[model samples]
Target: MANSNDSWFQTTAAREIHLEQLKQAERFNGRAAMLGIVIGIITEGLTGAGIAHQIGLGPLVDGYAACRTQFLPFCF
Candidate 1:
């Protein structure tokens, strides 16, 4: 009876450790999301500049305004 109880305890502990590892992986992704936001800001500036340079600021702003009215993400 004692050995069987010990085995049960060990399995429960292992299960908890696995759960914590999964939680840690999700938090790690949240940290990576911060980096992604920084990258997105840089890309947004570059994209706006590229559009204005190639087309014109008026058209670039118009396109962004249209997207803002129509889409969820709004071009970026």
Candidate 2:
């Protein structure tokens, strides 16, 4: 059987390591998100289209609305 003090120390050390890793991951994710937002804003300004339009969702949404209102036979 392991000593109770040794077991407690090992658990505490592992927890500290995981906490550090979590902090580093959060920092990286935040930086990446900010970069993506900046890029999206620049693209929108250059093209005069929103993020959704840039990704081609505008057409799909319009088609869906037309189909619902006019009962089109085929809508894609």
Candidate 3:
């Protein structure tokens, strides 16, 4: 009985720590979402692919297209 109760008490501390960490994660996730919203507004409704292209991923996208067209023609 004593050992069983001891295990339960120990778990509360671990559970509290996990809850604290989850709270911190939620905070950062909200901030990131807000930042994305601001970026979307600034870009005037540019979607993810458009934003990637604007930020210099255009060539990477083009390269992927070239690869698909050449080797894996049925890829994407």
Candidate 4:
């Protein structure tokens, strides 16, 4: 009898099941990426801010610059 703990790739049926799961995961990942792109574009069009600014990195960068120049306590 085969060991219950044997790797799935050792059998044809297990390999097919694994491949099908991979395909489903790939499809879901692709859809999620497309949705993110669409949302970013729409948000940019509505708010005039790029994705980075929309996600709030803009202010953080500005603060870093300010701290470098003025030695602000918040920089710590």
Q: Could you give candidate 4's per-residue lDDT for residues 1-76 as a string of tens digits?
A: 3575454436867788899999999999999999998999999999898887888766556687557766466773
lDDT of 1 by residue, 38-66 (tens): 77667668775443344345444657755
Q: Check candidate 1 and list the clashing pairs.
A: none
Error of 2 at 75 (Å): 15
2-70 per-residue lDDT for model 2 (tens digits): 699899999999999999999999999999999988998999999898877777776556688557666
Error in Å for residue 8 of model 2:
0.8
Candidate that would win on TM-score? 2
Ranking by lDDT: 2, 4, 3, 1
Residue 60 displacement (Å), model 4: 6.6
Better of 1 and 3 by TM-score: 1
lDDT of 3 by residue, 1-76 (tens): 9999999999998999999999999999999999987786678565545655766766556678657556445433
Better candidate number, 2 or 3, judged by lDDT: 2
All predictions: root-mean-square deviation over Cα?
7.3, 5.1, 4.6, 5.9
Worst 10 residues of 4 by lDDT: 1-10
RMSD of 4: 5.9
Clashes of each: 0, 0, 0, 0
Error of 1 at 69 (Å): 26
TM-score for each model: 0.55, 0.69, 0.51, 0.62
Between candidates 3 and 4, name the one with more favorable TM-score. 4
Residue 25 lDDT, candidate 3, scale 0-100: 100
Local distance difference test scores for all models: 0.73, 0.85, 0.76, 0.80
Q: Name model 3 segments beyond 4 Å from true.
A: 44-49, 60-76
